[model samples]
Target chain A: MDTAILIDIVKSGLVLGALYALMATGLSLVWTTLGIFNFAHGAFIALGAYLAWQFSSADAWGLPMVPAILLSCAVMFAIGALLHFLLVKPFERRQDIVLISVITTLAGAVILENGLQLIWGARSKQIPPLAEGAVEFGALSLRNSELILMGLVLAILLCVGLFLRYSRPGRSMRAVAQNQDAAALLGLNVPLYFSMVFGIAALTAGLAGVFVGTIRFMSPSMGSEPLMKALIVVIFGGVARFSSPIYAALIIGQIEAFSVYFVGLYWAPAVLFFTMIVVLLIKPEGLFGKYQRTL
Target chain B: MSDLILDVRGLSGGYDTTQIFSDISLQIAEGESIGIFGPNGHGKTTFLKTLSGLIDPWSGDIFFCGQRMNREGERGSRKMRNFNYGAVTRRRIDPKAVARAGLIHVQQGNLLFPELTVDETLSIASTAARGRKGWTLAEVRELFPRLGERGSHKIRFLSGGERQMVSMAAGLMAAPKLLILDEPTLGLSPKVRQELCDAILSVRRLGLPVVLIDQDVAFLEQIIDTLYLFDHGRFSGRMGKEEMPDHQTLMDMLFGEAH
Candidate 1:
């Protein structure tokens, strides 16, 4: 266990944690507020990565790197809103809503995945890093992209945390999450908040997609890995508590990074799932979550 | 007609396919106070819910502030998750629409969002005030000084009585043209009930209409301009302020109808 190797592992863990936090926060929000997992979340990430590639490349928009990513995020937001209203809202009225949402959103994921393949081709696409140079401190080294990704994730989380705390709509969203009937009595538009939550969730997932695409190659199926990690983070973080997912994401990210470091890459999933089982057995609610209202 | 803030005609509503009450009707003139007293499971709360637009009448009409409050026709095919069978039919006005129209319902048992701070609960109503003449959060605090003291505390952390006070304060913050309370004293101690009765008395003095439901006739008698005996989902008797009968007589009319 060299000091430099440990620092390198910690650096990679933090970067992975930052990416997981972005995706998991969105997953946590949609689940807590809507009580439905946006299974299309993974598809949204793939869409975002492909969109970012198209926008940044020379043949397409040839846009600057930052604007390209931002544009991709905006598009994902629109897609999320559309998916919610068109595909999800109708089924929400049915009995067995959880089942319906699962079926429909999984179908939506298929459509989005194939849609990406049709548009962007099945080949993996790479996005250039927003910054090109790495910085070294003593024996520790960090890639410029990883540093930027971590910073951006922290900045987004901070803004979202503040928004949910101080802004009126943000407060109303919390009120709805806490109690929809009471919120309606106070004249809060529940459906409007639903759309906003979905939009923002998709936006964050898309941003994560773009950041990951910058670091690694993206394919139509790339979203599956991130989506799996995001779900684990959300469950580990607790569903309703906003801050839980961030911590959960970081822990899961570090575990995956270090497990890969110690064991082989193949053992990462087994180790990760096993750790989650242990955590769930002890705190079924979440590592950071409080006892939620049961019915 | 405009002076009648709430006018229900031949209203019948209940859990789907089972009518709780039928052919029921009532009216509240501007600034009027009405009390409904009945035993539990006798539809007192159901009637209040219907008036607040939380439930739809099986077959009836409701008019609030000269606007038809029961959304009877063309609700635009919005599927309702709350309704039985998750149907797309429209029977009740959207509760938000009803609240916007100034008929606010404070549901039973201080059902505030448990996680929100008292400040946030009141702020929801204040932000959605929509220019209806009602108390601002500052004014609500002035009305219920205890709320001012506990403004920063979460509703879940409050005492039962404090939660009730927060509920009432939140209702007032919405600036309702009319307020409906369902069993505000349901679980309170006698002392807390008295305090709540006093608060209701003061709230009535603020020149707003109120419709109160409680099982306690003595408490209802304290604040109501008129009292209605409710039993088995129907209003069996009505008494003006001067004509309020003794507790035994009122009890007879209520439970007497129960069996």
Candidate 2:
């Protein structure tokens, strides 16, 4: 590839990595803490994207993008809590909760897709970029939209990391993730924690949706791509460590970007999948996950 | 002096449809230590669980501090029933109610949070016991001096003995009037077991009533003032501290002549 093309690939990789990290961090948190691999996570992202698209237009509401993003996140949080209570909590004690969550989330994904089609119609929708400019540095040109997405992802990740590290409820969630029975004995309400954690996960997915929707077209099926990418990133990063998703996302993004330029568009996903399989076979615990007693 | 701390009359409960124990009645007074001795699969743990509100007895009444305990439908119930074969049934009694009633149950195995430092665990325990004037973290650290040194270490990094001490300290932080210990020394080394026994006796010295449940007669003999021998879901015999028999008989009762 030419130097300009290489620079473009590198920039694309960083942008993709940031969005992937944002999407997968919540999955990792839920997996490590609640032991539930929420397949509907992508659906939440799609919902956020569609909401933002609806709000971006200067209709009677005329809501700004930042406020629209926050509103979408808040709505997603409530939806997340509802999902936890209705779908997750009832099956909490089941030994097959992992499998059940997959099926449940798959059902949720289908429902969300169809529901979006019914309400918003099947046509693709777009949200205008938060800003209308591009930054050029040497051979590389970065869209304002990409920078805004990166900024939003970083800000959300920092807030979430701080919350999990410092807040009392956040500490309790960590404690439960490490040892649930102990958390309960300490009078930490396990169900409440589950709901709160799921809500946070949904919030992250929602913000990511807005970023992704602004950059690309929003549709019912938009969740599938990022959902797959997030799952791959989370598995590659190891579920136990908090920073695993970031590293995994970076690696995957760079490889995807490079493969797209060197090989073909269809070949990039194949390379990503091959990398995931190799990592799983070589180190089943993912790159950063620790082997510990799970709940 | 005649007040009853816990009273169970005709209490019966089991897993699924299979009844493990029935018509079991027991009572404990203030500041009295009772040791529960039973053979394997005799429902000793089940009984403790039923009392803690972790499980629902099939038929019985549980009264604590003169209040009838509705184990069937109460929120955050305390009945703790663990099953090896099937689903474990656990009902958490409201921590507030448990504190008000001065009851704390330290379950088997290492129940400490693996990610939390020993000090954080104790601090959380102290905070949970804020409604009640219970033991402080400093006093708990004093009780288990090893805990003092390992305050910053996570429970996962601690030795089995150290973990047990942390669990005990967390339980005692509630300063419960009635402390229930279910197999407190299951996986401990001999030295650690001895330390745990010493800790129990020391806690008893502070005039806190305790319910120590174990299959080992020798350990119970050291700290228990009274013994309730359980056999096949029934209380087979009751022995006072002075009336306890030799090791051979207790061993025979526990394992049934090894054949």
Quick one: best TM-score, which candidate?
1
User: CA lDDT of each candidate?
Assistant: 0.82, 0.78
Cα lDDT tens digits, model 1, B1-259, are 8888788898887865477987788888878899987777888778777777666667778898989877673223223435444334433567888888888899888557888888988887787776776687777777678888898998889988899888888888887888888888778888887788888888887677788887676777777888887778888888898999877877766557554
Q: What lDDT would candidate 2 get against the real structure?
A: 0.78
Query: Candidate 1 on A1-295: residue-level lDDT in tens?
Result: 7999898888888989999999998888888888888899998888888888899998778999878888888898898888888767766545588887998899999999998888888877788887888898989788787788888999999998888888888888888888887877877787788888888888998888888888889999889999999998887778656788898888998999899999989999899999888989999988887777311
Model 1, runs deviating above 4 Å: A293-295, B73-91, B257-259
Q: B1-259 in candidate 2: lDDT tens per residue?
A: 2488788788877765577888888887755689987767778887776666555456777777777764444222233322321234334334334444566778777657877788877777765665678888778877888998998887889988888888889888856778888888888788888888888879888778889987677778877788988888978878899998876788687668993
In model 1, how large is the Cα lDDT of residue B60?
79
CA displacement after TM-score superposition, residue A293 of candidate 2 (Å): 5.9
Question: DockQ numbers for every candidate?
Answer: 0.52, 0.28
Name the DockQ score for candidate 1.
0.52
In candidate 2, which residue ranges exceed 4 Å CA deviation? A54-56, A293-295, B14-19, B53-56, B68-70, B73-102, B130-133, B187-191, B214-223, B245-249, B252-259
Give the CA lDDT, 0 to 100, for residue A152 in model 2: 74
User: For candidate 1, what is the DockQ-based docking class?
Assistant: medium
Fraction of reference contacts reproduced per prediction?
Answer: 0.59, 0.20
